[model samples]
Target chain A: SQTIHQWPATLVQPVGSPLSLECTVEGTSNPNLYWYRQAAGRGLQLLFYSVGIGQISSEVPQNLSASRPQDRQFILSSKKLLLSDSGFYLCAWSVSSGLYNEQFFGPGTRLTVL
Target chain B: SQQGEEDPQALSIQEGENATMNCSYKTSINNLQWYRQNSGRGLVHLILIRSNEREKHSGRLRVTLDTSKKSSSLLITASRAADTASYFCATDESGGSYIPTFGRGTSLIVHP
Candidate 1:
């Protein structure tokens, strides 16, 4: 079975500080990874998605960026965090090029920018 | 652009009652998926209905898709307090677009 892991489970970052969240997939190779943010009482906003190493697609322009350093390793980073950058961040992975595979989610990282 | 938008942003229902949430989307799709999120945790995939299919069942959950109107509904039978969570609908236009677009989820509260 495939599983996704994300950490730190919870984060508290001061304003203007840097942020780094990591996501890794187990039991799968060449999976498509995605980063999503959910504001309180709002819908999820897709931040970035990566198909392969060194490749990423930004869905929305924000203070965050994502990278696929390895086939199953994805990282979401921010040079300087903003108050608006706080939200419940999720990492998901799906079978690469699969006909109808659902995206599996990680436990998720709750970031609070104070 | 968001492909799905849920109706009645929030719903409150008593335990043992049926809970139904609706999702509307734009464009044609290959399938529509329903997901549930508890508190601030990651979402769990509930069910997926393909375009050719009209309804699907998984345990106590039922999903119906209306392609002509570009809408879908998730029905939970005999809900419980533990079932209180937010539900989201994601549309996959698998014809050529590989990305699955998600919508603003519907928050369902099942009070015991």
Candidate 2:
């Protein structure tokens, strides 16, 4: 039983506008996708990660960008938006290469770059 | 410049008392996770100690690891109030490069 979904839980862009956040994983099937960010007090900021479909692995480097295309879909992009980019946006999942690789999160997305 | 470092950034227990948090990291690790956030939501995988293993629990949470002095500690028993939140300590790096390196958390405030 695996389930991780994220959407526009809350967002308010402006700085330069243009950002899209979306993550999906139901019942798991080649999971292993992540993209964390929580700056306000700092901590938890691993940008992007994926282990399949197109494969992406960026740790940190500004504006933000990530994509996984299929295999459970995972995306988090941005073309502008910067006010430090805002924060609190997670979306994780594990169990793709197996072996006790704990990591399951979702239900987050609170951007506010104005 | 953070491979993990959480030590008394904030804490104010009271619900049932018993909340300890401490973490220190620098290099050489194979595992050391513990997360739980509930202020902005997300993050909730609390317990993963394996640097050759030192301690690990779940139900009431109890983790301890000290690969020499890399440090790690998280003990929250009897505490409630939804367990307040904010507690992180990650560091998985033993060459395999599994990706995990977070710190700067420890804001538990369970005062009911």
Candidate 3:
């Protein structure tokens, strides 16, 4: 079965510090990957999605960026973090861009910027 | 918005009782899906109902979709304390739009 993995299950970062979160998928090939940020008691906000390597689409303009360095490896980075950047980060993968877009998520990363 | 907004933001009930949650969206969709999230964890896909279909069942979950009303409901029968979690609904439009919007989920607490 396919599974997604996210790193740093919990993180505490100081303001102005750099941020890096990684996500990888196993048992699947050429899967579509997405990055989402969710506030406490709030829905998810799409930050970035990639259909293939070196291709990324950003949804919201903010202090975060995403990169697909490999087929199944996605990275979320920021040069400097902001207080508003604190939230639960989720990584998800879908079958592809066409039919059966059902998404499977990875264990999230909770970041607290102090 | 393309998101499905849930009603009764929070619900509490006793175990073995029936729990129902409603979700409404603003546009046409190919399908609607329900997900469950335990506290501080990832979401698990619970059930999915297609626009062409009115109802679907899996285990103890019953999902109904009303395309005309652009609404969907999730009914959980014989609820248990282990079923306590946040429930979210998401809509997938007919077109090829890949971005999915999700509303603040409905929090459910089942006391044993």
Candidate 4:
């Protein structure tokens, strides 16, 4: 079975601080990875997605960026955090290639920028 | 703007009562997916219904899709307190893009 993992389950950082969150998937290769942020009691906003290693796609212009260093390893980073960046950060993977498929998500990280 | 919108932003019902949630989308889609999220947790994929298919069943869950209406509904039978969470509907475009757009979600609360 495939499993997705995320680190720093919870984080509290001061404003303007750098941010780095990691996501790794075991038992799957060349999977589509995505980064999403959800505000309190709201829907997900697609931040980034990657089709393969070294390839990243940004859905909305924001303070965050994503990178896929390895086939199953994806990282979401920011040079400086903003108050608006506080939200539930999620990582998901899907077996899709321009085809509709179900996505599997990780436990997620709760980031609070104070 | 959100591509999908869920009806009855929030719902409360007693255990054993059936809970139904509806979703309306704005454009053509290849498939519609349902996901469940416990409080402060990541979402769990529940079911997916292709545009070509009208209905699908998974254990205690039933999903219905109407391409003409550009809408879908999820039915949870004999709901339990554990079902107290948010349900989100996601739709993928029929075009060449594969990214799925999600709605705000319907918060369901099932009293034990």
Interface RMSD of every candidate? 1.2, 7.6, 1.4, 1.0
How would you encode candidate 4's per-residue C-alpha lDDT over A3-114 as one tens digit per residue?
9999989999999999999999999879999999999989998899999999999999989989999999999999999999999999999985657678999999999999
For A1-114, candidate 2 gives per-residue lDDT tens digits of: 888999989999899989999999999688889888888888887888888988998877777898898999899999988898898898988887644567888988999998
Arranged by TM-score, best first: 4, 3, 1, 2
TM-score, candidate number 2? 0.34
TM-score of each: 0.96, 0.34, 0.97, 0.98
lDDT of candidate 2?
0.87
The list of candidate 3 runs beyond 4 A from truth reads none
**Residue-by-residue lDDT tens digits, candidate 4, B1-112:** 5888998799999999999999999899998999999998999999989999999999999999999999999999999998999999999888836688899999999999
lDDT-wise, the better of 2 and 4 is: 4
Better of 2 and 3 by TM-score: 3
RMSD of each: 1.2, 14.4, 1.0, 0.8
**lDDT score of residue B78 within candidate 2:** 94
Q: Name the best candidate (by TM-score).
A: 4
Give the range where candidate 2 chain A is weakest over 10 consecutive residues by summed lDDT: A93-102
Candidate 3 lDDT over residue span B1-112, tens digit each: 4379998899999999999999999888887889888999988888777789999999999999999999999999999999999999988777846455676899999999
Residue B92, model 2: lDDT of 73
Clashing pairs in 1: none
lDDT of 1 at B69: 91
lDDT at B63, model 4: 97
